[model samples]
Target: MTLKSVIFDVDGTLADTEKEGHLWAFNRAFQLWNLPFRWGVPLYRELLNISGGKERLAYYLAQHPEYHPLSNDEIREIYRLKTNLFMERVRAGVVALRPGVRSLIGQCYQEGIPVGIATTTNYDNVETLLLRHFGVQWKHMFPVVVAGDEVPIKKPDPAVYVRCLEQLGVSASEAIAVEDSAVGLKAATGARISTIVTMNTWTYHHTFLGALAILTSLGTTQTPAYGTGPDGWGRYRVTVDQLRAWLV
Candidate 1:
């Protein structure tokens, strides 16, 4: 099958938005709320297994009853505040696209291959990162953006990826999904889409069992590409051509 479109996951796949972006924002929210709670790196890393921000917070609250008396509405509000803080930090230029991301996206655009996003992160966070990186007209570049709030279920469920494929009017066989974690890999493969795994700091330890390729990053000509999988193309930097070859 010919590759018709490329769908991307936002958080770790697009940029290191988890540790540098959302985790910081969540800590800031807790501080602002005068809550005696903070998510250190190890705890936040574990919490990332949960898909959504509010869901993660709810899980944390349940684990530690001391933080109770915090209702669902309060959790939602805290997540909202965290989103705002994340956007502010993004606007301040702390986050940047992963290696080869801009080049690959631009290549796809130049070749008339539509790019879409399927992320469990909220739309506002998506907009913030894209606008900061791709400018005010980022929506024109990414025509299909199915975010967390838009989906009933999150990754490891395939709902978000399925929605993205639906919005793009493309079948799973005709598109490739780029993900950064095992949960995301599950989501993409569950939708029957071929996927590429690009591991980030927080997710590097997670297993990527069904990935077509698992790499440190979508490497550029300037950077060495290193990966381990049944796919042989991991020896060098992955390009649009390599992705097409993997479509099978």
Candidate 2:
């Protein structure tokens, strides 16, 4: 099947948004709220298993009922605050696109292959990052962006990826999803789309059972990716040509 589109996951897959972005924002929110809880790296890593930020917070709270009880509304407010903080950090240039990301996306655009984002991250956060990096017209660059709140269920469920494919008017077989974690891999594969796993500091340990390629990054020629498969491709510095070859 020919590759018609490339769907990317925002948080980790696009940039190291988890560690340098969201986690810090969440901690900052907690501090601002005087919540007495800080999501240290280890705890946050484990919490990442839970898809969305609000859901992660709720899950953590459920695990520790001894902490101050916050209603659903309160959780939403905290999350809103966290999202604001995240956007502020993004605008301040705290986050950066992963290696080869801009090159690959540009290549796809140049080739008329649509690029979409299927992420459990909030829509606004995605926009913030895109606008910060790709400028005000980022929406024109990424025509299809299906975010966390847009779907009833998040990753590991496939609803978001399915929605993204639908919006792009592309079939699962015609698109490739680039994901960072196991849940994301599950979501894309569950939708029957081929996926590429780009491991980051937080997601390096997650299983990527069905991914077409699992790499350290989307890698440039200067910093080539080191991974398990992509059989015929050099497996170093995944380029647009390599992706086209893989789709065959």
Candidate 3:
């Protein structure tokens, strides 16, 4: 299909902001509050499966109540602190978009294909990155940014995708979703939009049953497959050349 638009997830898909930036911000907040709690990378990654920062903290509290001693309201306050710290880090230019993301976004613009960001991350966080990276007129570059807290449900629910389509004025069939995680794939699939799975650090090993194609990167023309599996059953690693051939 000649795609009309491409929607992306934020953290793992369009950027690598999670590992260092996100983790650091949360840790900073923990220290400031003198909370006897901290997250390992593994725990952080697992918590990411939860939607929002506040929600993640809530999940952690639920997982191990003996850890934080903070109530829901307290957790929310801590999240606000973390968000502020995250914004400070962002201002320091520590957080950034991932490899090929800026280039691919420019390419999509040149190709006249609408691009969007549909994420469970905060809107201000997305705006901060876009504003800092793309500068004054960044809003004109891309208009659709569907954030997690904006809707009643987050990823694996499809509310954001549905809202993004409405905002972009495109049908589900007119665009494609690119994502990095299995949870993300479920969200896109629930929206009934075709999805391309890009293997992130931790998601590559999980099943991507509904993905239209799975690629190492959004490289060049590669013929991708539908209904790929846990193994490489219906899937193959793609290259720029292969993508072109597979597009038909």
Full ranking by TM-score = 2, 1, 3
After superposing candidate 1 on the true structure, give the runs of residues whose Cα lies further than 4 Å from its correct spot: 229-234
TM-score per candidate, in order?
Answer: 0.97, 0.97, 0.86
Q: Write the per-residue lDDT of candidate 3 for residues 158-196, one digit (tens) a residue.
A: 999999999999888777788988888999888888887
Q: What tens digits encode model 1's per-residue C-alpha lDDT throughout 1-248?
A: 89999999999998978777899999999999999899999998899999999999999988998764588999999999999999998999998899989989988888889999999999989998999999987887899999999989888899999999999999999999999999999999999998889998889899998888888998888896688644664465777887888788
Q: Would you give me the overall lDDT of model 1?
A: 0.90
Model 1 weakest lDDT span, ten residues long:
228-237
Model 3 lDDT, residue 66, Cα: 72
Better of 2 and 3 by TM-score: 2
Model 3: per-residue Cα lDDT at residue 143: 77
Backbone collisions counted per model: 0, 0, 10
Model 3: CA > 4 A from native:
219-248
